[model samples]
Each structure stands twice: as structure tokens, then as C-alpha cells.
Target chain A: MRAGAAGLAVWPRWRPVHDNGELKSGETTMAYSEKVVDHYNNPRNVGTLDKNSAEVGTGLVGAPECGDVMRLQIRVNAETQVIEEAKFKTFGCGSAIASSSLATEWIQGRTIDDALSIKNTDIVKELSLPPVKIHCSVLAEDAIRAAIGDWRKKNGAE
Target chain B: MAKRVESAVAAACPGCAAAQEGRALFCAQCGRIQPPPGCDYFTVFGLRPHLNLDAAALEREFHGLSRRLHPDRFIRAGAQEKEWSLADTALVNDAYRTLKDPLRRTEYVLKLSGTWGGPGKEKTPADLLEEVFELNMEVDEARAAKQAGKDERAQRTGLEAARARVAEMVEGLDRELRAQWPAWDAGAEDTRRSAERAMALLVERRRYLSNLVREVDEILGE
Candidate 1:
């Protein structure tokens, strides 16, 4: 077997992400907030939409160094263009999963324009992300843009 | 362990005249800690920076080096020698890990050559870019169907096909990498230049493979 593979399975390590991206440091290693853990544990709107419905947009982003990937999807109401639903699936550290999970929660009920106003720093602040984990927030913000951009292009609103 | 920026230092065995190599823990003549040495992972095993490594040989050498580097052997030594043993042991462990994995070895070699972990600048291939756009739509459709209590069999099939396509692409690239490995291991000057070009493919292959793994997970229900 590979060197770290055995250790990883026995001890919490990268990959095999638990629900809400459980912290792997230790039993008492709760570096994240309850809110972050809560969002991660029970990410709201964790589903997909009909992208062909002319009302859906999807964004996928990953950090190469950290091996983190996030896919955020949004469905806009045709009449109001407000995000009727937002969903996400993230494969990353706890902070990244939380950031995307929180992103999906916050985007619902907001118009696409309003969603655009969401910032990485806001996510960093909201999740209380450390400086090193700040990239996770950045990925969440970028996923929003990419999803929205895809929606706009398909809807001829670009 | 992390590499340092110190200039190369060579030390000699205090008990014997045998010249100590970089990071040699013991004298060839006397079983004493050799003089302090500095070397990176490649230097630790006296390996050249390349992807086509003999894993069995590397592992064998790693075990041999690890035994000597083990700090337990230094319990009776001076404080500085014990500390050096621990540090060198840590370094050897990290080196063994990095050198053992083909993908990681490629990345490390590129990094040592100042080529890897730069700004993310690769453009998505036009074909794959279009696929990503289409795949997103399919994913949303599958999700929407699943949510609305509608039949998502079609959408699920669509995602499966997309994943298969990406998998096939990655497999092809991996085959190319395997073909290039021996050419690189030859290590002639001309082959080295060609190997550099091959390293570009290795990097791109890793990026695509990483994305494919994530995409597969997303489609196959995480």
C-alpha cells in the first residue's frame, strides 16, 4: 500500500469528505464555527435543477494545490430573475464545503444581480475563515460568477 | 521535509577518513554520525530529477536510509547529533513519499526546475470547455428531475455518459504519459529536452484528471 493511504483511512485525512466537511485535526479541533459546521453538516438546497429549463446556471471551480472542487448551481425565476433555488456540492476541506454551502443558502431569494454582490471577503467573514483557508471563500465567490455567467449566456442576457 | 536555502555543506567522519556524502548519518568506517550535510529529496537518494523512477529500487534505498536516519539509534549520541538524526529522518520520510508517487514525482521535479505551481494559466481545450457547459446543464436537469419527483433516468444516463467520456480522455492521456516515461528515463541530453515537453502533458493530465475525479464524484452521487 502507499505510505499515507493507510494512515489516511485510519486517521482523518484528505478525501472521503464527511458530512459538513468534518474537521480532521483532532476530536477537539473545532477550528470552524458552529455556523460553518452547521452549514456544512446540513447544507441547504443540496440538489440540482434542470439546466435545460432556460432558467438554470451552474459553476464548477477547483483549487489545484489543495485539491478542492466546488459546483454551485442556481435556478432563476423567469419572471423575477430572483434565484428561486441554489444548490451546491463541494469536495474540499471543511472551509470550502462550508463556503459553498453557505453561498447556496445566501443566494436563494436573491436576484442574480444581488448574488453578484456577494463577495469572498463576506464569506470569509461570515464563516470566520482563517487566512490560509481564505481561498475556499474565493472559490465560492468564483463559482457564483461562473454559474451566473453561464445562465446569462444561455438566456441571451450576456 | 521542506527544503532550505543554505549553501551546500559537506562534512567528514570524525572517527575515520572516509569522505561523507550529503546528509550521511554514519561514517562508512566507524558507526558514528557523519558530519552535517544538506541535500534535498533528489540528493538524498542520489537521484536525478525525472519521472521514470524505479519504484522498487527507490523503496529499497528509502528503507536503508530510513534505518540509519531513525532517531532511536541516536539516543546515546550528543544532543546535536540526536536533533540532526530526527531532522534527517523527517526529511527522508518526506523524500520517500514524494519520490514514490509518479504524479507527485513529476510535480516535484517540475517544481525543482521552477516550472510547477505557478499562476494557473492553462486555457481549457475548446472541446472540453463546450463539454463542461453541456455537462452543467445535464447536472442541473438531473437535480431538478430528482427534486420534482420526475423521472431522472435520462438525465442520470446523460451524466454517466459524460463521465465515461472524460474518463476515456484521461485514460488516453495516461497512456501517453506511460509511453513517454521510458524515453525520459534514458536521460540523454536530447531526451531530456523532449522530457521537458512531455512534462507539460503531465501537468495538464493531472489537472484534467483532478477535474474528472471531482466530476465523477458529483455525477455518481458524491
Candidate 2:
């Protein structure tokens, strides 16, 4: 009985918790950020934009020399400054895909200023990305800012 | 197998009455020599005979062709046809790999246009010769210093400094190429000779930078 009691004491008291109405697992897992991995495995907004649209902002960044090419587009309402839609097509590795996806998700329904304010570091933190993949998020964030800047320039808004 | 033979004969020698059987070198009726299988890289890819090209467009075209002509898609073909397919695919991959990188592309273009020979085999540009000579001398001095077991720190520092200089030169040449690209694309026929001259300079610059980078990489073991 004493040996069994000692064994029980040594064993970690594993208990699932309710944190902010969501269940939290006690065990450590090596699984990647589910949202980022999902987007990487199955990418969204993978296509070109309609250049004819006046309300669209198109930003093409990255070089093949760098082994990455990304194109980001945002459709915004002229007066409201709200992002109606966001899309991206990237030719890069899994990190790039996840970055693009995260950027798309962050920008939808947000104002141009809000979208531009979203930093690469924030994306990195949210996705729990490693150091090597931080640049992918930076590129995505740069694309978002570039697209917004283009939109504002087109509309003659400072 | 028989079907493939018929198709190959028809494809290679259209409208020939006498279709030679089983890899014959000559036509039975006309006695004319048959051309070799597989087209040249330029002909097959439909690219102009130039060193400079749009890399993005080349990649897109390569992927499109690969989807259709890859050997994996020709598994049902007989031995000879499969062999041709594999060889052709390999050639395509090689061409794309060589053409994608700017320095290799320049060297290949020079060779194709009958201007430059192999590595360290061409005349150095007059303006660059002195600097190139100086850099080579510096590299040799550093190597000698390391061999003598004296001033190892200084030798290593000199090597790193030389590598940095080469990296800066590479960046400058890359910038020049980027600046010249749009103008080259939009230039008038009368300005084409000047554009070609500018392109030749860029190509030479790329060659110099590539050699420098290779030397640095070898020393650094990178």
C-alpha cells in the first residue's frame, strides 16, 4: 500500500481544465499551431486578382532568387475604408502559405489603418513560428501594408 | 509497341510512304537519313536565342510543359518511347535549372552566341582587369600566410573582408541588372544595339560576381 501511494505521489496529477469556457489539455504536445498548419496543408485565396477593378489594391512582392513570390490583393470600400475582401497567391514553402493565410484572416472586415497596424511579430507570436519562418510572416505583413498604401494612393487619400 | 512505332514514324517523317520498322536509321524508299529524336532546348521550349529572359515566365512555361511531357505520364508507352520521354524530360529539367540562375544563364548565352569560352578562359573586361588581379593577389597572399602559420588571424580577417567586398559587388551588379531590365524590354529598334551592349556588360558583371562568390564559398566551406 505504501509503495502504491508513493507511485501515485510521483505521478503527475493530470487534470483537464476549463479556461475561459474552453477545454485545455494538460499533456504537452508537439503539434504545430492548428490554424497555421491547416492553412499550409490546404491553402486559401490561391489565384490572381482582377486588375480592371478600381477598388482593388494589388501588391506583388518577393523574388524567385529568394525562392519566394507573393501577390496580395485587397478590395476595399471607397468611403468606409473597410476591407471588403482579401486574397493572396504565394509560390513558396509551407511557412509562406501560412503567413499569407494568417494575413488574409487578419485583414478581412478591418479598416485599412487597422490592417496596416498588424505587425509581423504579432503573426509570428500567434502562429508560434520558429526563427527561420519569421521572415515569411514579415513578408506577408509587408504585402498587406504595400497593398493598403497602393489603395490609398489610388484614391488620393493621405 | 506496334502502335507506338507507327505513331513515331508518322510524327518524325510525315507523308513518307515507306515507314521503316524498328529503329531503322534510313528510309527504305528514299534512303534519306532520319533526324535524331528530341528537339534542341531552344526549339522545344520556344525561347529566343538570348541570355536574358523573364525567369517567372520561363518557370511557368516549364511547369506547363512538365505536366504534359513528364515520364511518369508515359508509363504505358513501350521501351523506346519511354526512353525518349525520360531523356527529353531530363533535358528539359537541365535547361530550366541552368537558365533560371542569372550567372549560369549568362555563361550559357555567351557560349550559345559564340562570344565567351569556359571559366577563366575569357578575356577580362579592361575596366575590371585591375581590380580582379588585385583580388586574386590578395587571396593568394592570405592562403600563403595561412600556410606559413603566421598571422592566422590577419589572414582570416583579410579573407572575410574580401568576401564582403565580393558580396557588395554582387548586390551592385544585381541592382544594375534590375534597373536595365525594363528599359531593355521597352527600347526601340534603333536603341537595341545600345541595349545589347548594356546587356553584355551585365553578363560580364554577373560572371565576375559568380566567380568571386564561388571562391568565397569555397574558402568559407558554405
Candidate 3:
């Protein structure tokens, strides 16, 4: 038995984003919310930050289920620990893109600790994400936590 | 053999009241197109639920079934016969396509055995996620460099190298997956369950890597 085999039941079946069309042909697909469409169309802070900079923290996360990849980065003020800037890039469905876009918008200007308080449920509520797409919000939350974790590790801050 | 909830042979032919071949698309006694069997895909091909399949033999069977079940063969017959022909042909096509591919075949069997879960449950290994994310970063950087027209040759090389690496990983994972087939095909219950979990993990990882390769191809304008 391999390590983590106990969690095997939860591992993804793995559907590529491109496969969504083929899946739709087989069965019905739910429509995206208007907010999801808007965010997907014009995502905010879609760019990269300087990873080498001491002030910046980069978090890269993926949804194993849909093969969606997201990278969230934060530039923080060392003394005050306030997030000065935030950016994100997500390669996923509309819900995922919207979740991360909303995440970046929420984290900017907040302290690192304050940003950490943001929850996946908060994202789902804000985006009106369906039950199935709730994982996308979870991915966004994980990305935020990962980014802050990275920043904390670099700054050696508690 | 996998459990059978319903059998094609159990149903008497509507035309001649003759016994049907469990997998046959047509009734042998009356030469009538049979209804699409309520059985699994493997049963549709006259095979047990097993992971290790004979690809060449499957292809031959599929061709034979497709030719006989063609709707054109029933044009002179009544509307019911024509409808049966189309439905049987569709079932055969779907069964053949699903069974011919190695990954799809394994997944089908796994599902039949109640080992494979449907979609929505997905949690990637943290280490693998880290590795995939790092590769994505490199790919993104390469694309940005190409867009800026800075060291286009270097970016092309980097992208090619990344694609090659992902492809190699997929092939390696596939080989490992195929190796597990026999254990599930004929082994005892313990071995079969172990093989199922292993194959599931391998298939999941392969899909993730394959998607990366596709993304790399898109980045390269392929």
C-alpha cells in the first residue's frame, strides 16, 4: 500500500478543461452565474509578481479534479504586514477564474493576517458558486493560504 | 465474470422466439436486430469484465458488428427494424470506442466492479501539486519571453523540453498502470482491490500530466 492510499477515495478522476465540451455533449452542463461570467471575461490582477523579491509571496495551487492551475502572489509591507498589492493567474473554468479574481481584489490592502481570515465559503457566497463549483472557491482559498504561508516563511514572521 | 443484472440471452426473440447470443447484435435464429442489451460494455462484446483485453480481436469484432448493424441493411424493412438497427449500431459503436482504449477500458471495468468512484472527489498530492505548479511557472515565463521577442530560441527550447518531460511522465505512468491490470484481472479479492487503487492513482496522475502537455502545445502554437 502506498502512502496516502487511505485517501484514495478522494483523489480526482481527472477531467481536462477541454474535455468539458465532450462531457457536455454526453450530459447537461450547468450555466455559469452572471458574476462568474463577468469575472471570467475581465479578470482582475491577471499577471505575475517578482518571486525573488523579499516583499512578495507566491502561491501556486491546482484542482486535481479539473486540472485547473492557479497562481496567487502577494506583495506585503514588511513592517506593517499589510498586503500592498495582489495578483493572480488561473487556468480553469469560469468559477475558478472568478474565485481567484475575487480573491486578489479582496486581499489587496489588507494585512497578511487579515487576508488569512478569508474563507472559501466567503468566496462561494460572494460569487454565488454552485455546489459543484464550490471546489473552485476552495482552491482559491488554498491559494491565498499558500501565498501567505510562503511569505511568512521568507520573512520568518510568526 | 462481473455480476450481470440482466442478460440478453434471457430474452426470447420477438420475431421467432429463439434464444439470443448474449453479446450478438442480431438474433441468430430469426436474423433480426436485437434490442440494445441492458448489460455492461464488456458483455456487449461477448467478454467478461477484465482489464487485460485483446485489442486486435476487439477491433475485429467491432468491425463485424458495425457492418451487420448498419441502418442501411434495414432500409427495406419496417420502421421498427430500422430503429433497432440504429440503436444497436450506436450501442456497438460506444462499446467499441470505450473498450478499445486502454485507460477507458480499465476505468469501465473498475466502475463495473464498484471500485471506481464517479467525478467530484479530487485531492491532489501536495508534492505533485508543487511540482506541477513549478512547471506551470516555467511555461508561463517561456511564453512571456516569446511574446516580448526576447530570446525566442531559448523560450522555444524551454517549452519543448517541458513538453518532452511531461510526455515521458505520462508514458511512464501508463506503463505502470498496464502492469497493474493482471492483478485486477485474475487475482484474489485483496489483490484486485489493491490493483484498483493503484490504477486509479496512476490514471489520475497521467490525466494531470497529459493536460500539461496539451497546455504546452497551446503555448507553442501547435
lDDT of each: 0.65, 0.59, 0.74
Tens digits of per-residue lDDT, candidate 2, A1-158, equal: 01122111111111121211112444333245676666665566554467458798976554211224456889999989999899876645456667887798789899998898999999898888766466678779878987888788888885
Give me the runs in candidate 1 sitting further than 4 Å from their true place.
A1-32, A50-56, A65-68, A75-85, A91-94, A108-117, A130-133, A151-158, B1-38, B70-73, B114-174, B186-222
The parts of candidate 2 lying over 4 Å away from their true place are A1-158, B1-56, B106-122
What is the C-alpha lDDT profile of model 2 across B1-222, one tens digit per residue? 000111233334332666545233334576433332333344445666444586677888688767766657667866665665555565567667666766555545444544444223333344463355345446645655665677878878888888888888878887776565555456665454465556556666554454555555555552
Q: Against the true chain A, what TM-score does chain A of candidate 3 give?
A: 0.83
Pick the winner on TM-score between candidates 1 and 3.
Answer: 3
Candidate 1, A1-158: lDDT as tens digits: 11131111111113322111223345445466776666655656665677677788988776654545577889888679899888876655667777887898889999999999999999999888866677789889989999999899988988
Query: Where's the lowest-lDDT run of ten residues in candidate 3 chain A?
Result: A1-10
TM-score of candidate 2 restricted to chain B?
Answer: 0.65
Question: Per-residue lDDT tens digits of candidate 3, residues B70-132?
Answer: 667787988877877777777777778678878778766766665543444446666777677
* Residue A65 miss distance in model 3 (angstroms): 4.3
